[model samples]
Target chain A: MSLLDIQDLTIEAKQGQGRQAIVDRVSFAVPEQNIVALVGGSGSGKTTTGLAVMRLLSPGLNIVSGRIYFEGNDVVAMPEGELRRYRGKQMAMVFQEPLYAFNPVFRVGCQIEEVLQFHTDLTKGQRQQRVDALLRQVEIKDPGRVARSYPYQLSGGLRQRAMLAQAIAANPKLVIADEPTSNLDVTVQARILTLFKKLRDDLKLTVLIITHDLGLVRSLADQVVVLSSGRVVEEGPAGEVLQHPRHVYTQQLLEAAK
Target chain B: MSKDKHFVPSPGGLRNFRKNPWAVCCLIILGVFYAGAFLADFVSPYSYQNEDRSYSYCPPMEIQFLDEEGRLARPFVYGVTISFDEFHKRNYIIDKAEKYPLKFWMKGDTYQFLGLIPSSRHLFGVDAPGRLMIWGADARGRDLFSRIVYGGRVSLSIGLLGVAISFTIGLLVGGIAGYYGGRIDDVLMRICEMFMMIPGFYLLLALRAMVPADFNSVQVYFSIVVILSFIGWASLARIIRGMCLSIREREFVLAAKVMGLSDFRIIVRHILPHTLSYSIIAIMLSIPGYILAESALSLIGLGIQDPYASWGNLLSEAMGIIQINFSPWILLPGFFIFLAVMCFNVIGDALRDCLDPHFQVDENI
Candidate 1:
């Protein structure tokens, strides 16, 4: 069974007196223990779709009609109380810019521990232990030192890893990464892709990556869903989709990628 | 590495403030007044209500350390004999024949120390018939100095209590309105606007007028505090709401929401705390307003009544030109009010400068 089934989802933004659909009838599924890349160019509604999956869409943006099923439960219709439980525990997200994502005032460890604190019943000592362990799992050298430093104190790569640690602290069923490698260097991006692969294989974790980077999809994604102007243009195995483009927009996107 | 400079620690931290000499001086000045107000019962020679009607409008007694033979002696003041003037106003003539020496820790009016310990030992007092009226006496023959000290308790504490009550409401209201923007924000902002629309002084007077006149001094003091606080929070809430609107858009706030922390938790922990540095500086500046509000109410006879002095009611004695001409010392409470307000403004300005750079960083975001 699919870990997450987003069927006929339509999202609208307020424009003048009428509402405009940003994501129109987009349907896709993230299978268990698989990496699904929702690939698209800018303004493709990829980020909005990712946010809708977590019900984290900003004000003025509304889910006009859709059902987001996570473990057979309709996420769009879930009550706030239960949705809160689903977030950071059953499903988690990592944003693009770790520097901005983490609270600047707090240390790396404290931010990660906040997720564990809310989702798990771990004691303070156990939570601290879990935080250090999570940091190590992200292949961060000197977990204690990195944990003690504030988000701004660390390098961009280290901050992103810390953010990833926070996302997986609750051992979530699915991790949604929104343009996670867009803000990092080429070397750091390669390492991050390797880390994502390790997370999928070792932890048996499902990941839905929202990005326009074809290179990232080629290296990391197993399944591909190509989106163009709020609609799904193509979907197939990542190798097939990248090798033989079925849609004109997909062909243009591949040309732009090169 | 250069980003480290941009993302420094707390902007309101005292590191910059301590280097500013004027800020330190203002802090010390405020400290002394607060200390005097806190220990008023023990520091003042006479109780606030202990008045000798015969000594009404008496000039300040000068303490002499040299005796008749020009030899050094304990501080003493001669007795003052009262005489009626041409206009039937009482005049005080110094009678050097009777010399009364002052003593420290002297037993005077017996009262509870801090409402915990029973004691009558005053810091300094003169013998009977020779009063130690340092700042002279008011129209009611009460020591002006002692009244100012006692009045400081009401005047200084009203500001603190009022700010505490108002800021709590302001921060919470602003945080909630800003965090969950939409219908809630519209309703709260309009309510805030309604409050801000009314002139503060008129609102203060109208609210003060609402309280029953027969309430005791304690009740009146609390009501006045509540009135000032009610008028005070509206503006602060509006400012805080603006700040939260910006802060709520910061990525960290969104991250907190994604963490599944409840709305209240996010508001208080993430959103509200980001506005704290601004709130604290604002609090320092606004305290003087509360103090002045209390004084204004008391001056108008709508605040703390007589026998229990506040700086405003104490200044009421100097309203007449004759009182100002004959016994100018009656205006001493006005001087204390000026000093307190000046000190608070100086410190608040210094804090703003110290935290100004942090605000620049925030603006960059």
Candidate 2:
């Protein structure tokens, strides 16, 4: 059985005049310990699809019709309380802008510890120790130092790592990273990709990496689902999809990648 | 490993605060005022409402003593001797020292300290008739100094209480409006605007007039606080609502929501904390305005009345030309009013620099 299954999902956002559907009949499944890359251009609804899976869509955006099954539980049908229990612990997400992802007022350690404290029965010391270890796992050189530092004190790469550390702190079954490395330098991007690969292998973590970069999909994703204008243009094994492209949009995306 | 293991102290906000001297100075001034207000009984030398007819119009005392040679000493007035001038005008002098030594906690008139502790410690000696007017006499020869102290108890406390009431209501209303933007936001904002449209001073006056004239000083004081708070909250609410509107969209707030944190928790923990630094700065800044408002209302005789030593009431005595010409010290309350307002503003700015994230880190740092 798939760890996460989305069947015939549709999401609509209320824009100026009428309800414009952002994600139309999008469907995919990720088995346990697999990395799936949802790839598309800006405004292609790839990110929207990820948000729908997590049920973290903005206020105006409505999940018009969708059935999301995660670990044999229908997410759309679950009560808010049950969904809350699964949100940070069962499924976690890393936002695009790491700088804004963490609260600037609080130390990075406290932000990570909040997740652990909320979901687990850990004491203050235990939570702090766990946060420190997670920071270290994310290749933060001085975990204690980074833990103590505010978000503004850290570099973009460091902030992204801290965010990743926060996401994985609760030992989530599925991790959704939305444009995780889009804001970083190319070199930092490579290192982050390597770190994500390492984390996935070590923890047997299922990851849904949403990005516009097909190169990232090629490098890290086991499977790829290409979205265009709220519709799935192409979906297949990452290597096969990239090598033998069926859709014109996929070819254009590949050309853009080149 | 060594690089990772090395100690790196998290820089403190104080280091940032030091970079702005103006803020530090303001903070110090505010600290002084707060100390003065809190320790009014300790700092004040006389009862706020005490009267001394003999010490009327006495020039501030200049300490004098006998020389070693036992000569009449270098022309030092001993104690104040109030008398009529050749023009039959009231005059005073330091009657050469007759053992009117400064005293502490000497039993005189009674006062309820903080509405709880009952004590009789004037911190300075009373007059011959047990009246201790440190700042000399008012129109009726009441202690101006005592009134100022006791007046502060009303003037200063009104700002805080008013702010407290306004802040609570404003935060709730504004927070709701900002968080849920749309028709609901529009409706709330329009209501806020409606409140804003009413002439604030006139509204305050209307509210003040509604309170029964026979209300006691405490009731009157409380009513004024409520009135000021009612008028005051709209501005703060508007501010908080605007803040909430922006902060609600912040990534941390979105992150909190994605973490499955409750709406209330997200609003309180994530969204509210962001606005607090600004709100605190606003509150501090707004206090002087509140105090000044209360003072003005009291001075106009619509606020604190006679037997109350509010700076406003003290200044009310300075309204007539004769009092203004005869005793310029009546204007002394105005001086305190200005000082208090300036002190609060400076302190508020300083706190903004200290607490504001934008102001905390200097360019050089």
Candidate 3:
């Protein structure tokens, strides 16, 4: 079995008008120590898939049929309490909107420390040490100053780096990055992608980057799953899929990018 | 003066508050009311319930630093002689010869200091047989000054206590509804609306009417606080619910969820703090509402019970224009009520402005 197996995942959205499937019968796999990119256009339900596994799906949406197995454990079948324990300690997520991803009231260091607090029994001093180290690993030059600052104080690039720091704070098995670089400029995006490659190689971290930016997948992902309107159109080695696309939808997406 | 280059000013909430002079003034006024409530025993020479039959309808005595001979002397009050007019109205004339020097820390009536320590050492008093009636006596001859002091304790406390209960419910209920939307939101919000639909005062009246009239003063005080809270929470919950509808969508709240923090923890640590900042000002604004609510109930003989002092029942005596015209000093409690309500309004408004996040941002921590 693959390290992470998502089998026939189906998610539905219930609006005032009616209930409609947002992502239907979607399936994918990621072996251990591999970087897989969930590539799709807007409204393709790439982000929803990440949320479903975390059980952090938005209010109006529901996972109707799916079984996500991480390390041979069924995530969809886990109890709420167990699911909570499984979240920060075993797996973490980095969202696209870093500005909205942080609690505005607290300092960045304090926000990062909360995950350590909830998951690990690290001493206060030890936790502070860990936060500083994490910030440095994410390539923050002034880890001390950055940690003390609030979310609104930092620039978009710095905030995204702080977000990446939070995603890796617990040193979890899998780190899900949902459209992580979609909000950054090309220069900053390149830097963040470089950081991701470094983390995956140095820590042997398993990563899942969900993005509409096909360019991001070329540099970072080992495997690519191309999705169009909630359906997977192609799946193979990242280089193979990017160089010679099979599905017409994948061809159109690549053509649009070019 | 040597200026240091590294000295960057911190622009936090306290500094922002100090920048607004109006909030400071209101804060000082509230400090006075809290002081009066805290020191009611030491400040009031006579007990709130003490009534002297002969002193009824007597005009307030004038405390003078100059003796009758015009020599500068200790503060003293002159005894007054009472006489009946043709219409059965009582009048008073200060007897210059009967000088009663004011005493401080004098042992007098017993009272529980802070309702904890037993002490009867009053702050000041006059010689026996001459009342230093600054605010004068009521129809029952009860010392109005003492009653006002005692009344401050009840009227002011109800506001804080009532708003506390109300906000606790509002934050918890509204947070849950907004966080776990859908069926939960629909049900909880329907319950909240059911509370909002009824006319507040009538609802207060209906609830207050349910309490037996025979319950003791303390019981009545608790009931009034509870009734006011019930009437107050729904409106606040509606506001909180509206805020939560948007706040739950914020990225940090989502981050907390993805981190596996329990729903309760997310609501309390992450979500509730956002509402609490707004609630702090809301609590201050609504306190006067509670004070007024208590006063209205007492005015109609449904509140705080007779002989138990509260700003409300004390003003109940001045309901008739005839009594107000005869002895305006009886309106002393009315002045306190006005001061309390007005100070709260000013303080609330000041807090709302001062605590705004965009007030003035400085780079320093």
Candidate 4:
């Protein structure tokens, strides 16, 4: 059975005078442990689609029509209470800007520990232990020191690693990484991509990666969904989608990615 | 793996607070003031109302003793005998043979320590009947020193009570406005603006004018506290509302909401604590303002009236030119008021620096 299923999903943002549909009748699915990439340029509803799945859309922009199913449960009809439980546990997200993703005031360890504390029945010591392990898993050097350090005290790569550690700490069933490496340098971006690949294989974790970087999809994703102006222009295996030009927008996005 | 096994202290605000010297100094000063206020009766030598008519307007006395030489020893005013100063055309004093021994923790007039424990011990000697005005006499010739010691009780208590009232109102109103935006925010903020638009001083004046003249001193005192608090809360509410509006959108707040935490918990546990540093700093800064306002009102005959000695009521006597020129000691209350305000401000600044996240501490860390 598929882990996630979205059918004919549409979303609109209420502007000053009119409602603008940002995501229109997009559809996709992720099988268990599979990696899927949602590729598009800016304003292509790539991020919005991911947010709609998480139900973390901002005020005035909402899922206008959709059926999102997760493990046979209707995600679109779930109460806010149940949706929150699903987030960071059943599913987790890593935002585009790692700097703003984690709270500046909280230490990296505490931010990760919050997830463990909320989603797991682990005691304080156990939660701390889990956080340390997660940090180490993300290739954080001196995990203890990094755990104790605030976000501002860490380097950009370290902050991104800490955020990823937090996202994975709850042992989420699906991890949605939204342009995770967009803010990193090339070297750091390569390292982060490798880390995500390792985590996905070792833990048999499903991942939904949203990005404009075709190189990332080519390297890691199993399937790809290409979107433009809120519409899915193409969908197929990641290798086929990248090799053959099925849609004009996909070709444009591929050209831009190069 | 072993390195990740141990507990590590987060290097952030807590560590910074510990290393901040100015915050430490402010804390120490504030601690001393609170200790002094709490232990005033135990630490002061005379009762709040003990009278020594002979020593009225006497400059702070220096201890004296007869040397073996038997000549008049180094500069000490002899205990004076009350008599008429015919040259000055007023009652004056003559040097007496006996010195009034300064006492400590000696039994004097009784008082309720914090309105709880009954005690008679004072830190200094009581004045002789009708005098002993270390800070000079009020209109009734009551000792200003004792009044001040006692008045500290009223002034500090009123500041605290008023702050408590203001904080409660501000938190609730601001929380609502911030959590629920749009029309609710608009309506509530409009009310806040309306309150802000009113001339505070004139409004206070009008409120004071409305108070019945027959109301007792205690009633007037409490009423003034309530009035000041009511006026003060609007500013805090507006500030907290703005803070909440921004904080409510924070990911952590949304996370809390997703966790199914009640709205009240989100406000009290999460939202409220974030505003605490600002609120506390504001409260500290506002206290002196409240004190000064109450003092001003009293100085103008609208606050605590005579027989009830606030720093303000005490300074009211100085409005007369004769009192100002001849007995400048009457202005001593004003000096103390300035000292209190300055101390609070300095302490508040220190706290702000301490609580602020930007202040660097332990650069090596």
Question: Which regions in candidate 3 have their CA more than 4 angstroms from the true location?
Answer: A13-21, A122-126, A201-203, A247-258, B1-23, B85-88, B353-365
Among all windows of ten consecutive residues in candidate 4 chain B, which has the lowest summed lDDT?
B1-10
> Higher DockQ: candidate 1 or 2?
1
State the lDDT of candidate 3 residue by residue for A1-258, as single tens digits. 587899999999998898888898999998888899999888999989888878878768988997899999999888898998889878899988787898877889999999989888999999999999999999999999999987777888999999988888887889899988888889999999999989988877889989887888888899999888888889999999999999998888888888
Clashing residue pairs, backbone N/CA/C < 3 A, model 2 = B48-B146, B78-B95, B78-B96, B78-B97, B79-B95, B127-B131
Whole-model lDDT for model 4 versus the true structure?
0.77
Error of 2 at B284 (Å): 3.7
The predictions' CA RMSDs to the true structure, in order, are 3.0, 4.9, 4.7, 5.8
Off by over 4 Å in 2: A13-20, A77-85, A185-191, A201-204, A251-258, B1-30, B52-77, B80-99, B103-123, B126-134, B210-216, B272-281, B346-365
Worst 10 residues of 1 chain B by lDDT: B356-365
Which candidate model has the greater lDDT, 1 or 2?
A: 1
Count of backbone collisions in candidate 3: 1
> Per-residue lDDT for B136-218 in model 4, tens only?
55554455666776666666677788889988998888988888778988998898888789998888898888888899988
Q: Where does the lowest 10-residue lDDT sum fall in candidate 2 chain B?
A: B1-10
Error of 2 at B152 (Å): 1.8
Better of 1 and 4 by DockQ: 1
Locate the minimum summed-lDDT window of 10 residues in model 1 chain A.
A98-107
lDDT comparing candidate 1 with the true structure: 0.90
Candidate 2's residue-wise lDDT over B139-180, tens digit each? 666667666766777887888899999888888788888887
Off by over 4 Å in 4: A116-127, A201-204, A243-245, A255-258, B1-35, B51-77, B84-90, B104-121, B126-133, B139-141, B164-180, B202-226, B239-284, B297-309, B317-327, B345-365
Candidate 2 accuracy as lDDT: 0.81
Q: What tens-digit string does per-residue lDDT give for candidate 1 at B225-310?
A: 88888888878888888888998999888888777888898888778877767888999999999899999888988888999999
